[model samples]
Target: MSGVPMSGAPAQPDPYAAPDPYAQPDPYGAPMSAPGGQPMSPGVASAPPYGQPMAGAPGQPGYPQDPYAQQQQWAGPVIPPTQGGGSKAWIWGALAGVVVVALMVGVVLYVTGGDDETPVADSSATPSEEVDPSTEPSEEAPDTELVTDPATGLSFAPMPEPWRDSTANYGVIGFYEVTGQVLDVLTFEDGSGWIATFVVGEINPSQLGSSSMTTDDAINALADLVDGAHYSKPPDFTEPLDGLERNEVEVNPLTVGSYSGSAMSYHLSWDDDSIEETGESIALGVLDMGDGRTAGFFLSLPDSVPDEHLDQMLEALDSLTFV
Candidate 1:
């Protein structure tokens, strides 16, 4: 009975052997069975173990219902971090470009300043044409004006335009030609019936300190000298010859344009040969300019002439100047 084997004895499995085929497959490979021997229905996906991607489960169509199952395949390629050294280099390069642009602008401004002489003509405006000098109206020279004699240091106002300079030498006196004079007298004529005579002469030095002639007498003598030289008719010295009557003014020392002198005035009346038949022919002003010198001026205006002309002559006499 010992060698033959006892019926119904329990046996232990070998330690290093493969699993029996009838036993259930490993737990990790498939779903576990239910208590009644029916397989369990699929369960919800659990959180993945740490540090692993969720690929899929082991069953039919693995993880078909999981939302993130194919997320890794769908994502675009990863971009490396653009944080420290390369980023700073790009910023510095941009700053350098801006500084270079600023320097160029400064150079341009310095070369062309705000006050440069370039004329800024308006493009929309019409330009004006240049004018010719010959076509412009010119000013005409005056007819009656002042005349200066440099040699004699004299300036005569209201001198006639038609009068000329004389070549005749009058012995220590300056002479000017007059168109209206038939005698060799220095006469001036205004076309409107006015005549003036001017005489300037150096005096004898002896005549200054001890002259026998009184001032009034000397002035009268100058008048007489002019009359005798111009109108000496030879019948009676002062009679019906023009029937002239004379009135004299007191003579006094005066200063006329830098020259110390004596001055006198005279009024004359005549019957016939009077100026413009007005019974008076002339008015005279005489100066004995003293550094041994003298000047005599005579003016005659027809009554037909406007009184303004006579006034002008008188004004000219007042404004005499010696250079």
Candidate 2:
């Protein structure tokens, strides 16, 4: 019981046992002996306790020496850590691929020269088709009834209804003392005795009974004729009629059709006579018909006549159109 070992306990060593030939040779050389006179295997060396250095390790006394320890440290290139994800070489490869694609796109744009863009049109350029002035529609004048003067061949629009050409019944020769040929006579049918007379004659001073050197003088002479005939009693009159009181005369420039002229307007009153106190309104116009010929118009209206009649007569004068 003293020498036999129990189960799970370490076996005791035999002093007379022989060494096995197949065992591995010791690495540190021959075997060593303990202080108690026991033989020890060379493969088994005494190791120091935990937290202490081994007795026979390097840098310690009696440590075994290595022949090639002093030649050099490793001195190789450093390798970066490949711990997290993909390596840095793969990232650099991807960046180079992107730069190459960008350069290729730039080259394509330069070669095509941006041909997809549209060109701007010039605003000041003329159109291809020209418009013909004759083909375009023109504004037409208003429609009106027109009458032509037999003497001057000039045309005009006569006054509206109830007014007629009373030339046959009216005495055109003795109407005015001017030495000219009478052209036309117009009057109202209402027997108001109002009349409009037109005349054409030479610009001779002796014939018009004035210093008619210019057309303006002729116009003034025509105005003077109306003033002499109606504004005062004539020296040749047989009946003793009251001379009409005259208002201030107004002279203004007038344009009728293509003729330019002057017009004289005034009002006359006969207070003592059988005629109404609000007597009459008179207007006279003289236009230079050119080529030494002048045309004259005289309109006389009693105050009893409607104002519309006067307006109609004036409109008739404006409607003159020279042939």
Candidate 3:
């Protein structure tokens, strides 16, 4: 038991043994994680694995060699760096942004229309001073010498001088005297020895279908004055009579101060001998006042009448106006 006797001595772990294959390499003398864990510096490539060629070195991965000559051999070709890959992406992104902005501006303009004043279209005739039909009187009324009627809506001038003035139903039908032989029935004979008269009145509603009456209707309504049985007298009478002669009569359309009416004429025959013995005639004017009303002037005169008397009668007829 001399050399082999070893029983209760302390077991000592060896400080130096075979190196560990999986342990980390030394920092000062070895690569030490390739200097901050980077393979190489900027523009510098790492040395290829132990047996591989170095970058950009002859007979390395970057440089090619001629296989038939003594030149060094290269493993493969390398690609050269170019502009950044993000350049195209940046250009496309800028174009897309411009399109979006333009679309936004167009939408804003369309919504607002960019105008403050809206256009208006006027499709009416020219404007004029309006005259109220219910309030304004007719033009026949002068400043001081005018008379107005409210019932029929008419205006009348004062009767002319040297002529008698008469009215039926308180001026409903006005009568102005003219040159002629005075009769008991309020009628006169003109210089031609024919009867003359004038009257104006609102048309009877029974005779009118509407407010507007035609000139023919107005003339026909007064037919009794010229061709009725009461006015018809034979041509062979010595004594004077108050009747219209049944002779040929002519009727025509006429205009009087914006009024349309009828003008009529006929020969008088009061004598009992011949139709032409009387040498007198009648002239009549009947005007339509447009609102179922009328104004008429009749003249009975010799074949030849004084110009002065005729002019005066005409002036009176021309003075009529309607409201």
Candidate 4:
């Protein structure tokens, strides 16, 4: 009021403030908000306020190091499948089956291979084609002279013709006797306890035992061939026999094939050796064959003959024949 009766200076507005229409109310350059506003992702780490830096910021270099650099890991290789072992086993089994079948076929071929056209060697010896034994039915009695024995109620006969009397061939049927080195044939007259002996031939050895068995069977087949038979295996012999008195001798299971033998000997008398000065006068035998058939030589002589001449009996036996 003193200096001229009115005001001299006037007041001015702030320079950074917005004008009335674009004005913001917050003090820290933030837009004006409600009382409690929060950030969108509150857990994420925020930038440093003014001067501090982040721990592993990509743009920075030469800071702390990472510990897991040289560690190793593994992965396996792939394999292709082969043929099944079971299939291989089946193939082998099939081959074996074929081999077995082939063997069986071979056996069949062998079995059926025999010749059907081969002819028999001797037709006379065949049983079905042979002469009948029961009734010889011939007027000619061959060379044998049949005689009836009063003591045994038996028949004694001589060998048929052609053979005569063999004094030489002593292998099969001979007339020779052996005393050490010397061999002679036994001879006898019609007088005394002598009986006649019939003679025949040297048959095949295979047929020998069978012939013996067959003849034995036939002889024993008759009820009166012998009263009884006594089976004996004397220790002195290498074999055994079934002594059927005057009927026959049975040496079964004899091994004509084996190197060894079961040999035996025996004597038979009808209670009459009165004129005898030596041992018992009877029928003595050495051996035949086995195979159920054999060759036999027999003689009826006085008991006065010495034992040393037994080989002579065998030698005489070598002269045996069945007419």
Candidate 5:
């Protein structure tokens, strides 16, 4: 009864009791104090919990406010606004360029003299002198005598002197008579035995036993007569000369006194027992006188005469004209 009789005495602790499951465990393996407990060390503050603000931070009560926090918040950089929706500096630059160009144009106009002056002519020259036409000398023409033939109604200027009409003495020297009416005969003797004769005539076809003949036919017939030695000797010869020679005849168209005709020119030479050897140049022509009428002419010149005399004879023939 001694061990079972402990009812009123204080219960002693149980050495083998299980611990309480609802109690908080100590984190640092030390016993935890109750709320309002004392710190483990003096004058050492505790750090805040993991994510809370501490005592002296920016919004809290103890420390001075942050120096950068009260300033204005920085959004970005600041830029000045433009006037007229563009830069004023560009407008000023353009105005300066225009002023410089105006100054350059003014300088160019001042350097060149500009187009405004009128031109004047020089006046120191002399005038030309006048001429007098009345004092000039006049030219005089050569002296000539124009003679008209009565039978053929033709006019001409004969040689100036020592040439005369010898028609009345026609057959006195034994020249062959032409087959026509003898109109005129001009004869010249140069005082040195040289002589020439020009004969003019109207052709008579009846004398040649023909009713009609052209001027060409008459000239051809005359040429054939001369060529056949019908008129072999010169005018002062009584009979036919020995050894007569005729050269080839040159026939040419001729103009005489406004009438067209033909002429035959040839040279004849002869050796006569009564005289020395001699030769003559002869030209014969036939002209149509119009209206069934015709004319003929003959010229004979000794080779001893100067050629100028022959030229004069031809000039006189050129001067012949119908009256």
Candidate 6:
């Protein structure tokens, strides 16, 4: 129908009337304005293109070819960006919340895991209790049967039927021995009870041997020796031994009869077990080696074990031959 000519002129219908989805102007590069933009009559300027509302048209809307369909405070089909952005905002907020939760978890793990101040560490702390000089040795005598060689002062309690006595040990410091061999009635110098094994070693009182010293100094010196630094008597962490503490260790001239040699006296106690949230200051006496300088070995056992009965240890130390 677009090619049909006008009845009056018999002229060809406008070839451009068939709407080109692309081209708009009449064979011209000018932007197409509106369909009714031209005059109603051939030479009369009546109204603007369909886009502009005629002054007298009273709210007549724009035409089909208008670039913008509706124009006012708002326009048509106002599709917002990405579902109105509210849902997107919620989604992003959830994602952010997850990230925050993850970060919080990470921080909690980092802060809580593997701190230096652990209960195990506190549990393992060495203990020191004051030696109760008042205690007397028990009437019980040494279990000489446990003695392997009385001549050499070397001994171990008699092993049970399947166990053996005086087994030679291998590897590491002052002879460390664990009785894989079945044994019972283990006894030491004090005859208090059977110990798993006896660790015999020596301490080398630093070049500064027995000089004038306070009891505290002696304790510090003792603490240092047990720390495996027999050659260097380092100062102890000068804090009171609360509960059970590995207090001080040191080499001192403990004269018993005519014998005077370097002895490592470890100050240990079961004070902590007796008190709540703390330990007592008590000593568990472990005597000196036959002839050597030592600070001492100390361990804090929570419970008491005839620790006050240290006469045997004192006797043994006193009996040691310094030569």
Number of the top-ranking candidate, with TM-score as the measure = 5
User: What is the TM-score of each predicted model, taking all chains together?
Assistant: 0.37, 0.42, 0.35, 0.21, 0.44, 0.24
Candidate 2 TM-score over all chains jointly: 0.42
| Model 6, C-alpha of 218: deviation from truth (Å) | 9.4
Measured with C-alpha atoms, the lDDT of residue 178 in candidate 1 is 15
RMSD of each: 69.7, 70.5, 64.4, 63.5, 81.6, 47.0
Q: lDDT tens digits, residues 1-323, model 4?
A: 01111111113421212233222222112221111111111001111100001112121111122122111000000011122311122222222232223323433443455365687677677466666877786676566443322211222232332213322211111101111011111221321111112222212212121222333232222111111111111221111123323322322211111111122122332221211111112222222323322232223222332334433333333322221
lDDT of 5: 0.36
* Pairs of colliding residues, candidate 5: none
Poorest 10 consecutive residues of model 5 by lDDT?
42-51
Query: lDDT by residue for model 1 over 17-80, one digit each (tens)?
Result: 2232222321222212221222221112211110011122111111122232212100000012
Task: Summarize candidate 6's per-residue lDDT along 1-323 as a digit string, tens digits.
Answer: 01111112113432212333442232111222212122111000111110111212222111222233211110000011232222112222222232223323433543455364744436667876767867867576864443222222322233234223323321111111111121122122332111111222222222113323332343344343222211111122122223433433333333222222223333232222212221111121122333322222221111111222222222222222211
**True-structure Cα RMSD, model 2:** 70.5
* Model 2, span 287-323: residue lDDT tens: 5555434455544444344446545654555444444
Q: Report the Cα lDDT for residue 4, model 4.
A: 11
Alpha-carbon deviation at 307 in model 1, angstroms: 2.2
Clashes of 3: 12
Per-residue alpha-carbon lDDT of candidate 3 for residues 1-323, written as tens digits (9 for 90 to 100): 01111112123421212233322322112211111122111011221110112223222211122122121111111111123421122222222232223323433543455575685655685766778897866566546443333333333343354333322211110111111111111111321111123334433322222223354544444444222211222232112334324454556655434555565555544433212222334455555554334555443433333334434444444444444
lDDT of 5 by residue, 44-86 (tens): 0111110111222111111111232111100000011233342
In model 4, the runs with Cα more than 4 Å from the true position are: 1-265, 272-296, 299-301, 314-323
Question: Could you arrange the candidates by TM-score from highest to lowest?
Answer: 5, 2, 1, 3, 6, 4
For candidate 6, report its TM-score.
0.24
Which runs of model 3 end up more than 4 angstroms from their true locations?
A: 1-159, 167-195, 205-214, 229-250, 273-280, 288-307
lDDT of 4: 0.22
Predictions in order: lDDT: 0.29, 0.34, 0.31, 0.22, 0.36, 0.24
Positional deviation of residue 236's Cα in model 6 after best superposition, in angstroms:
22
Task: Output the worst ten-in-a-row residue range by lDDT, candidate 2.
Answer: 70-79
List candidate 2 stretches off by more than 4 Å.
1-145, 169-207, 230-243, 274-276
